[model samples]
Target: MSKHPGPSLAQHPMPWWRSGYLWLIIGLTLAMLAGGVVTVWLASQQPHAPVAAPPSQAEQGGSLEPAMQARNRTSSRNAKALGTGGD
Candidate 1:
C-alpha cells in the first residue's frame, strides 16, 4: 500500500448567480436604486419655491444698527455702575 493518499476530489462551488449571498446583495442594490429613483421623482414634482430670509430684516436693511449701538451703550453704563467693568 502507498503511504501517500490518493488526491481527494472536492465538489465545484455553486455559480454566483445561484448563491443566496449574491441574490441578497443584488436585492439590496435594486432596492436602494428604486428608493433613489422614487425620491428624485417626488422631489421633481414638488413646487420650487424660494426660501425667504429669517425674520431679522433689520440686520439685512441696517435699520437695527442704531438700536444695537444704544443697547451696547446702556450695558456699558450699567457695568461701570456695578464696578464689574474692567478698567
Candidate 2:
C-alpha cells in the first residue's frame, strides 16, 4: 500500500490567531498588567499617614491594672507552691 503524506500545514483547518483560548489568555494577561500599574500609581499618589506615637506613661493610667493583678496572682501562686512566700 502507498503511504499518505497526512495533513499539511497549508491544509490546516484553523490558524493560531483564530483560537479562542489564545485570545482569552492574552486578554487576561493584559488585564493583570493594567491592574498592577493602576495599583502602583494609586500607591504613589497617596502618601502614608504619619504613625501615631505610643501613649505615654501618664496617658496610660489604669489600663494595666488587670494585667498587673493577674501577674501578681500567678507569682503568689508560684511562690506558695515553692514555699518561698513570694519574698
lDDT of 2 by residue, 7-79 (tens): 9878987878999999999999999999999999998996899999998765987477787899999999999
Best by TM-score: 2
Task: Predict model 1's lDDT versus the native.
Answer: 0.83
Measured with C-alpha atoms, the lDDT of residue 61 in candidate 1 is: 71
Report every candidate's CA lDDT. 0.83, 0.90
Q: How accurate locally is residue 32 in candidate 2, as Cα lDDT from 0 to 100?
A: 100
TM-score of 1: 0.51
